[model samples]
Target: MPKIPAMTTYDAHPMHDRVVLITGGAQGVGRGIAQAVLGAGGSVMIGDLDKEAGAACLQEWQVGDRAAFRQLDVSRESSVRRWVDAALARFGRIDGLVNNAGIADPLREPLHTLPLEKWNRYINTNLTGAFLCSKYTLPALNKANGAIINIASTRALQSEPDTEAYAASKGGLVALTHAMAVSVGPSVRVNAILPGWIVTDAWQKPQKRHTPKLSRIDHQQHPAGRVGTPEDIGALAVYLLSSAAGFVTGQHFVVDGGMTVKMQYA
Candidate 1:
């Protein structure tokens, strides 16, 4: 196995006592990030449209430890503002906001045949949602000199059949990250993380099956020789949110296991 780069020092829990909010933290990568921050002794707020799951995560992680839950609709300005406000009210400050909530409806049709409604839905939920959340949370983040980590995808750089909306939305997110980083200026740091194929429970669905037909064991055939886990993304999220990454901003960091760098000639 290859060594993963130690992006930042653990340093006795660098983000301890800080307040962090993660959208869509009910499960998958967002949940993973929440756990990571909690473990590091930071307060966390889990925001999502799924009330049950979000509440469950809050109960399970106990953000007030400090941790809590907030029902949020990223596409709605009012909803987004409420959650940010709630986090600030609960913790008295905001240290970071992870725009990790997103939706991707599988499409069988090409762009020419794709439904306009579907395209709009994708852009609204995946792209515009992130923008709205950031816009509202910027003030809180600026107050804490915090970071905004937008969860993008490696698909932003590559394309797949029937994945036009997902790719386009993520691509737009990457651009937004840079623009936000510049706009937030010397106060708040904004960056994008492009995660590759991660086999989460949601990803286990037949409709969400990954391509190239490789077995679980062959996951490591690429340079790093394995599929990624939510924990991997979580660790990186923690680092980026911590003071250790103060010098990093306005960048798109790819966390794939070298899959994009390899060519399949077979």
Candidate 2:
């Protein structure tokens, strides 16, 4: 197994005494968020569908002392509820939730020919899954005066051909983020992060990890001169959950290297 990188230490633990729950926290942006939370002195409950990957991540991060992992299929209410209950049983309090699990396949089949199974899979796993997680975790969040951060995508706003299912699900998530914020306000803060072209292959499970291969043209196209990283979203998530962003809620922060703002003539 590859060694974990040296973690940057912080003098002040912004998330001290806070317990955050993250679905699909075993890899990619979810893993980055989990690491950032730990680095800032917060405990995390990582729920993922891949048990082996989740366990490997917790161990590799050396966050076993401050983290817990549970197998969760966010689309299933039973699984979502069980994960939430287990986190509560172990940590006894919940301060924040990162709804970061979802299928990201860009199935390009025309809607007229799209199978119902394909459509439901994307909607159920992406949109409905967030709904179930939020539903099950909201009570604890309210009791702790906590927050929710939904990991959406720029596809929610704009999309390419054959991206209807994924795009629609993400679009619904954006709407739900604000609706939920309004429904649970005065107690819990809700927000969404729409990350564009974040390269997360390096953050996947060790066995599946690979070095990213991006050409100069790819990096040059973005206004930021490069693609985004999991860390970019992670840092923003931690900040949103912090008291620093206390007055911020029902907002969608886009962290896409400003790619969405650049118009393409081709």
Candidate 3:
């Protein structure tokens, strides 16, 4: 056979042969993580409930057999198990997991006034989802000495108004990361990323338009000069997954641009 061109030959990052499963991969931070994994030459299984958007994301990141999508509702045990099984069937193995599926506090109500049902929904999706996915995929990931990156929020560390459930769920997730790290040691690693002020579609551009103008204080809050983008968090996620971070685990990484550090002055 003639010499194969090196450029045309298959090559990937250190993780090129690895397989990763990302929850909420249809949009925002999840979609960004999928793109990062694709660029690294890794096979990625995107699990999300948004079929239309997930299909679009898969097409956008099409790279031969390197990408796939599965419809998943993380709140349900059956759904989470199904996606994990499907990913293993297609890829034969799993190298890592990014638990990025979560819902914010639907209603901006005071904690005392928050509805029990809404609170349950937030806890189920944000906290319980990670537990279910991790519990089910432990076997496949353990084989590869894989990692788990939970997508937490700065709210887990700090707080704002009307965000009780979101903060609590994320804080619980951070704790969960440490627990898994210790319990799953010598075979697997677990960590969490706390992102601040990321301008996700759901956060920055809601479907319903707001009639009021943003205050100057809102514009001046971030010390980074502008709000964060999904890609910012995605880059960090990629780094944490790579072998470059082999010794790093059981840690919480905050990817905010000094927003949490700054002291608000009147």
lDDT of residue 238 for candidate 1: 90
Model 1: CA > 4 A from native? 1-10, 62-65, 202-214
lDDT of 1 at 120: 89
- Which candidate would rank higher by TM-score, 2 or 3? 2
How would you encode candidate 2's per-residue C-alpha lDDT over 1-266 as one tens digit per residue?
A: 99999985654778999999999999999999999999999999999999988989877878666899999999999999999999999999999999999997778889889999999999999999999999988989999899999999999988999889999999999999999999999799999999999999899998999999999998999999998889999999999888777899999988999888989898
Residue 54 error for model 3, in Å? 0.9
Worst-scoring 10-residue span by lDDT in model 1? 203-212
Clashes of each: 5, 0, 0
Best by lDDT: 2
**Model 3 over residues 222-248: C-alpha lDDT tens digits?**
787766778888788888887778788
- Where is model 2 more than 4 Å wrong at Cα? 1-11
Candidate 1: C-alpha RMSD to true structure equals 5.9
Flag the better candidate by TM-score, 1 or 3. Answer: 1
- Whole-model Cα lDDT of every candidate shown, in order: 0.83, 0.92, 0.84
TM-score (all chains, Cα) for each model = 0.88, 0.95, 0.87
